[model samples]
Target: MSDNDVRQFTVGPDDDGIRLDRWFKRHLPDASFNVVSRWARTGQLRVDGARVQPGDRLAAGQTLRVPPPESAVVAAPKPKAERVPLSPDQIELAQEMVIHRDAQAIVLNKPPGLATQGGTKTHDHVDGLLDALQFDGESRPKLVHRLDKDTSGALLIARTSRAAAFFAKSFSGRTAKKVYWALVVGVPDITDGMVDLPLAKQPGTGGEKMHVDEEEGQPARSRYRVIERAGNRAAWVELQPFTGRTHQLRVHMAAIGHPIVGDGKYGGQAAFLTGGVSRKMHLHARRIQIDHPDGGKIDVTADLPPHFAESIKLMGFDLSLGNAMIEDGPPPVTRADLKAKAKAHAKSVRKERRGERRSRGSRD
Candidate 1:
């Protein structure tokens, strides 16, 4: 292959610190791992003008250069899927999920067992049915954040790419407040408190589980209030997670001796109740508050699902409690902050800037 056939890509913020081989699989799925390593050995895989091994991690804003493929076996890139579409059936299904909608965003009371995004075995998802929420003729409604498949509740969708970017920054900046409602097997000893635990992926679960770990875990925090309890059988709890880690709430609650009801993954058999309660996971993303891309605060709430409603009714728990809007957290990093972060990230990606950081102390 000649130099004229080269292609280049800039590492995206989300892909930062990803292994080069994994990045290739994600962006260039047609390229095999053996082919990537061959390019590395032949000095054709380069990052920032220097040859890089496939094991090397890629950072945000880094320039990666790709040499021409050595084999004709590589398949041509497929045309990108046009903006999402909804069949008449999907439109009918999704129409019932829309609790709120506007020019900039759509709020869905996503049902349990429906995935927010497609996965290996998940072809049916809220992301695929977004055309139902397409306000205008253009069908570009985009998902801003994800709700766990079994956990039903509010899922926000941005109506445009500009709004998508804005909402994405809001979540990354930790300015969005999301409130979850769950029924736990056992009541917490305290009525209200915070669970400060570091979490790491549980081994041998194939990336589908989480557990508390002190040394090699990511920091996670969740504030909770036990709204009501039914004779030590179960409790209705409101949870607010400060850090958005996978399975944080489930693992945290299980670690605290009160696993969420019907959470067989983390809570084991104890999570099940004998008295005919639906075995479905009882967690719900009841409400969310985030800054709107256009203007004002986009605060929305969702109603309970069938199983959750049934459990609440049988337990005689106060259904009206804790549904009010929550106060907004710190405002999302401003546009100026985002720009500064991007600039700093780009500079840090340069090898020369590794040893050139400014002083840590304040000037004052």
Candidate 2:
């Protein structure tokens, strides 16, 4: 392709519904985002003969008209980061964690204490070991969702970009269902209830902690049902979070006054327990159900980690009783739904007050 000639490309099925800028990044590596933005700004970029923004979604079979590459507008290429080689042991460890694998997805029974992704002072993580999970695929599997460092169980990985996008939509749209198991301190008075609370990053915590803030916080809701109680000491419970937030499960459990065992960050000293119980976090992603890219659905369950299993055994709780409450409930309500509900409640209150006033006037 010469620099003077305009370029045209057809969007593929796999690239459907992706942003225009992302399409550029995937197919045209030489074109930087800045160059693409410049082209869009000058009306040199068109999709199906219509000018489109960088964030515009592209449909399959649509024609994309790209202007000729201009030397003055294109930025210098960035140096590619060197790929670190994985050791044989690391590869084996990664493969061992895989509990379910298909063409589109790989679900790992992630153990406690392993970070989902690398960060400051964190060298080992599931993201780093993902290269071993790439089994003859064109690209490495991508993480669709994350589990905290001390939280164990099912973590989904997408094997292709299309699958990644599909799984991400399921999660963001709240269609994907995730069930977690935890042993919390003290049994709740209510056997089953929903915690409709908002959460925000705690001040002075450097964004590492979350706290319940009804006044200024994002909406967060969690449903919990006590499965089995070990006297008054602790209770094995099933938790389903409707909204995903930072440290949401931990923060919600702690806010309800029944912190998950070994979660010292939110629970403090009360998080730990007496006797021979392991001081490791008890929360585990027990099950995940989401629609697959090709068709059908992916419903898989992860076995408990060693410590969690041991604690369950120590508490003498029957394993069979854990999944008694697996029936699905109403979907999570949106902000609009909440507003409508509040309006209806206010109207009902006003009607009741008017009736009370009328009855009092008749008595007088």
Candidate 3:
């Protein structure tokens, strides 16, 4: 049969009220949403063997048939005739040193500003330049994990599809560990504690931003420790995320009132260029530990990028002391300090509640 042949399936009770397009999305992972919508709109999608719209609510026990269009296979693009060489900036950023490399996977120190992979707007990415690094012949490197565009540090790439599948399963099963270093706006009340706040995507708030939601959100957990405190302005912190979510570190840090310094979108005025402090985001992926598919555990670490190092120095942190600040056990919190912080937190909470109530009253 041709690729455009119709496929039929019966919906179960759990599939009720779901849009036809969404149902198809769950069933066909590789098919784009546009393709599914087109099939529904052209009367190629049927419910009980009758034509149905893309937005039609699915019913339990309904027989669905979808005559999908022939899959369009596009040949990979060939390099242009006059290909320009990689610029010095590109070379500087892309010249990652391999920390560990085996037949299954490769770990490297990914420099800041280079994206892990190309998107709709991005053209040059680490995945595109894998051949230059002499990774497994012409086979393109697949990203096992991702760092933000501005965040620099340890990055993992799989050399083969089987290795990629193994790494993906490891991450999903929480066997992979990732640690990050950040300079937040203020010292947290607790020197070390776990933030077990659940997070969810807020509507209309564009970009990769998330918010702490008490209800209807996914569970997110992050363990944090204060590395050092600098006056009343900023504190160096180490974070270990127990769950992998987009922008989890940034959002969680902001929720705790200590937004990561130089995070313009999340930190607000704290990240602004003022009072002689440089305006570079002082966040880095410090370390990662994961089990290899070939039988051994791998530990990889990256040195702080120059900007982060400079920020730490400017804040008067002693680099010789290393990143561990709570080594000899955490110091006790004074009774007076404890009382003062409790009062401040209570006041902030009350003020926030009052504002929320006023907004709700107005809406009503």
Each prediction's whole-model lDDT (CA): 0.84, 0.90, 0.75
lDDT leader: 2
Model 3 C-alpha lDDT per residue in residues 146-251, reported as the tens digit of each score: 8887788889887765566567667876788878888888789998888878888876786467888889778788888987888777888888888877778888
Give the TM-score comparing model 3 with the true structure, all chains together: 0.65
Per-candidate TM-scores read 0.70, 0.87, 0.65
62: Cα error in model 1, Å: 17
Q: lDDT of candidate 3 vs native? A: 0.75
Worst 10 residues of 3 by lDDT: 323-332
RMSD of each: 11.2, 3.4, 12.4
lDDT of 1 by residue, 213-243 (tens): 8999988888888898998899999998888
Which of the two candidates, 1 or 2, achieves a greater TM-score against the reference? Answer: 2
Order the candidates by TM-score, highest first. 2, 1, 3
Better of 1 and 3 by TM-score: 1
Pairing residues by index, what is the TM-score of model 1? 0.70
